[model samples]
Target: MLRIVLLFLALGWNPVAGAAEMGDDGLHKEDWFSITFRDVAEDIVAAKGEGKRLVIIFEQRGCIYCREMHEKLLADPEVRDFIKANFKVVQYNMFGDEEVTDLDGEMLTEKTAARKWGYVFTPTIVFLPEEAPQHVSVRDAAVATMPGAFGKWTFLNMFRWVHEKGYQKDEHFQTYHARVIQEMRAAGRLDAE
Candidate 1:
């Protein structure tokens, strides 16, 4: 138990969270995650129609970090509920063979798309702006990208930052996260938890 807690601490995870569940594909499943045709443009449009932003998460089967993300940050209701309310999430398998259409209208397999996007990590999250420029790849159109799993606070703050369009502001994410943490500490929220 001590070792597990230490591991979570080393990984920057809060250690108080839990998992959603695993699917037959060996990936974690979230009921609210969108099932799309894997077309970036269409997905963006759909998300916009629903008044939400599009977010794509790339994961591979049997990835420990991916499992960590699902089991820890994503499983928490506070984190999960905010994302579900504000964003349209799409899951993509890093090594999958499913067809995916890029924003540039180029069709490729999931594996190829991941390669094209230069995603080198499982659970790489790409957050797209409300308007994606045509003839550009998803990576090029992405407003922000999280390259790997982070702690619950960091993860939730990233989502909040993106939802609030904080990227367009002068305050960077790290700074925003720090400020949020400080506020939480000042309010005694972190201490209560």
Candidate 2:
């Protein structure tokens, strides 16, 4: 256990404060929402034919916030189902050696894609049209890039906000968040196990 503690510290996992959620079926309760985590370029190429947008989440092992969101926040049944149904999910390590083709059709390493795409932090979720450039904003103009693990509500709200084009007028995420919260409450899905 001492070794594990030291490892977590080296990897930078802060102590989590929220209550861990339990699934109704007595499992950790991850949703069926799955994203592809490799060869993003390839996936984008495929999406061009199908006209699908992609949400890529950059995650590193041992990241405290990433663990919190994936383990605590996304453990909720609702969020999982929402993501699985809406996005093409992908998760990748920051310092990995996987190969991915770039938009230019150049073959490069995953690390190169991170640097080229300006992935500066752990748990950075990049939203882009499947065939769009990284700099081309999908729905959120200023913050097409999000860094770090946010609360469950905010994270989940992002999917709906951007998908529905709510960023056109709002300057910040709070308004959209408030609206989503109201909707969630209305549906009585906030406390969904």
Best-matching candidate per TM-score: 1
Error of 1 at 114 (Å): 0.6
* Model 2: lDDT of residue 71: 75
Per-residue C-alpha lDDT of model 2 across residues 1-193, encoded as one tens digit per residue: 9999889978978554233433332222133334343555556555445444566666665567776776766766667667655666555456666676554555566567778677868888876554545533222322356788777778877876766656566545677788777887998877642
Q: How accurate is candidate 2 locally (lDDT)?
A: 0.61
TM-score of each: 0.88, 0.65
Off by over 4 Å in 2: 1-37, 45-52, 130-143, 167-172, 182-193
Separate clash counts for every candidate: 0, 5
Candidate 2 residue 176 Cα shift, in angstroms, is: 1.6
Assess each prediction's global lDDT (C-alpha) against the native: 0.90, 0.61
